[model samples]
Target: MVRLIAFDLEGTLVKSVSGWVELHKKFGTWEKGKEYAEAFFSGEIDYATWARLDASLWKGHTKDEILEWVNSVEYMDGAQELIEFLKKNGFKIAILSSGLMCLAKRVSEELGVDYVYANELIFDKAGRITGEVNPVVDFQGKGAILRKLKDELKPELSVAVGDGYNDISMFKEADVAIAINPHEGVEGDHNVESLYEVKEIIEELTRGQ
Candidate 1:
């Protein structure tokens, strides 16, 4: 009896491996961004500091410019079909990601998702990036958020689908954890090759419920 489904944005719903990395490449800041990422992974800087450092790299860019880059990101194959199937079956859809909010909001709106949670880049009064961010989702904070949502939504069962290590926390919180084309070493209750397979898995899970 799955009543809610949570998805990871980058690599899960979208074809991009990382919206942050893509933006860094687009803005010509990948080298620096890579350093920050390494620092975060090596236990040097914290997630907030890493995010701030990454956001600072895009300081002075217009919001429209960033939006344009976001729009360029393509959806994963069968993303639309899978989402439509979930909606048609009356499941609440949520996107919980540590990625940028611009892409999350875009995907949520286009797919008609019920809930979205992601980090947001702050901007100045002139609509330019201000090197600041509101870190709503941390790399390992997805479980806590999902726990809160479970209390609030009171769903009979909740499912989570993702493709990265950051999604493992989310997997722990879900009644059903699905890893779709997951990164190496990432595991879940089920492993799927694509979103089409994800739809099939869900269908079988809910077949008699």
Candidate 2:
């Protein structure tokens, strides 16, 4: 029976405009930026260099400006209802994201979820973008945290839901993996196009309803 449900923040529960992507679209081709970005995220380059390049994309934007831009992000359809259902059913809900903590905290408070695991963006006292993320969590690192949570909770079963390549990494540690209308590929253990559909999967997975 599934007992805990973990979700990815961006492109899963809530989706916000990509600050760096927006900059690239305004100044140049997004593909050009993504080519280098993919490599950086894949570990071909150091995180510091990646931060420098990512920051350069924004040029002179203030950290608050960026946060405000993201604050307007919209949650996926049925996201609120799904969270409510999980909570009502006595399941542990966690937001597992690779997003900035500032934005993550905002979303967490809005959704009133239990726990949040994400990265932190560094800003100067002036609240200007410093172009650095503290302890960026991506790739296989997510699985490590989920595994630890599973051990601690000792739940009958653990589940993870998301729609990005990075999210698929948690499959090994989760009892069930759900891919929700993935923006890139359909390689998750199970795939769906709607949050309501995901709720059904969870309902069926849970042992006594």
Candidate 3:
């Protein structure tokens, strides 16, 4: 019955706690960005404003520098293997993240995901960061997107997996929600210590009824 599996990026696909924080650290604004991140989470500022604030901190950075940071991201244990198994099993693999489009695109291609949804981090014609961002939606907006997908594709069974507070909304939208290396106290139908364990869950979910 399972036909779709959506994943979060920062902690789920990559080991980094926050892709935005990673970029901020690489570009020398991690500390300042933290305040904005807090505001974003508290609903004091919208995602577009938060994204632009992050971009503002990296104003002078170049595309190459950002890519260098993204390229250095380490994949979660068994992330590639899990992705392969999902594709092979005919699951519509989707990556839904509040992370930047640059990194999301790379992750989508690397994982061979069927759908990717992420916010755009803009760049100038000269390949320099533009200090602007095209916002998709808030972290909670992941649920909205997933709901839209369900309405359109109507997957017989849907699964959403993530590791942090932001994923709770999307998880609620899924028939089966999984938490991978979840933050303390986060709850889900399944709590897994590693991505490799997802294989077992998929097997159980997909086994013939």
Candidate 4:
């Protein structure tokens, strides 16, 4: 009955582990950059504030440089294979992420997923980072968008895969949730280390159905 499968774009789909951290490194925000994640997870800040903070880090960087950074990202091994497998198995695919839309859009288009919900970064006409962003999903709000997708796609069941604190909300809404190579204490119905294992998990879960 799992008809719709969703994937998180950062750690789960992109192999670099953290797209945000990559941004921080690229923008010279790593000095105090890691602190923002702690603030975000501790409820000290929301995604909007977090987005603004991120933008502040890249304010002087050019759009071309940012786009180059985004394009240089490497995807998770087996991501393309797993996506193709899901499609072949009759599941409509989705991407629910709090990550930047630039990379998510690229992955979704490459995989041809049915839907995607993610945030966007804004830039001024001069092509510089504006320190402003439009958020599509806040922390703990990923499920809200999934709920919206459910209403639109009308799937019988939903499956999700992720590997971060932000992804915890997705686990609650999915009929089947897999935490992929998670951080030390994150939880899910099942846990895995790779997208290859995810395919196996799904097959076993839906066997004989």
- Cα displacement (angstroms), candidate 3, residue 154, comes to 1.1
Could you arrange the candidates by TM-score from highest to lowest?
1, 3, 4, 2
Q: What ordering of candidates by lDDT runs from best to worst?
A: 1, 3, 4, 2
The candidate 4 region of ten consecutive residues with least summed lDDT is 14-23
Which prediction has the highest lDDT against the true structure? 1
Name the top TM-score candidate. 1
Residue-wise C-alpha lDDT for candidate 1, range 35-145, written one tens digit per residue? 999999999999999999999999999899989988888999999999999988879999999999999999999999999999999989999999999999999989888
lDDT by residue for model 4 (1-209), tens? 44888888888988766566788888779866778778877989977897778777778788788778778988888988988888878798888888788888888898898888888888889988788888887777888877777788887768889988778887888888899988878888999888999999988866776
Which regions of candidate 2 deviate over 4 angstroms?
A: 17-32, 41-43, 46-49, 56-60, 183-185, 207-209
Off by over 4 Å in 4: none
Better of 2 and 4 by lDDT: 4
TM-score of each: 0.97, 0.84, 0.94, 0.91
- Local accuracy of candidate 2 as per-residue lDDT tens digits, 1-209: 43787888877887653545655665564776797689887889865566456655555557667666666778889999998888888788888776656677888898887878876666778887565666556544678778878888888878889877667778667989988877666466788988999989888877475
* Clash pairs for candidate 2: none
In terms of TM-score, how similar is model 1 to the real structure?
0.97
Per residue, candidate 3 scores C-alpha lDDT tens digits across 93-206 of 888888887888998998788889988878899998889988884768899988988887888989999998879999999999999989987878999988888789988898
Displacement of the residue 8 alpha carbon in candidate 1, Å? 0.2
Tell me the whole-model lDDT of each prediction, alpha carbons only: 0.92, 0.74, 0.86, 0.82
Preferred candidate (TM-score higher): 2 or 3:
3
In candidate 3, where is summed lDDT lowest over 10 consecutive residues? 19-28
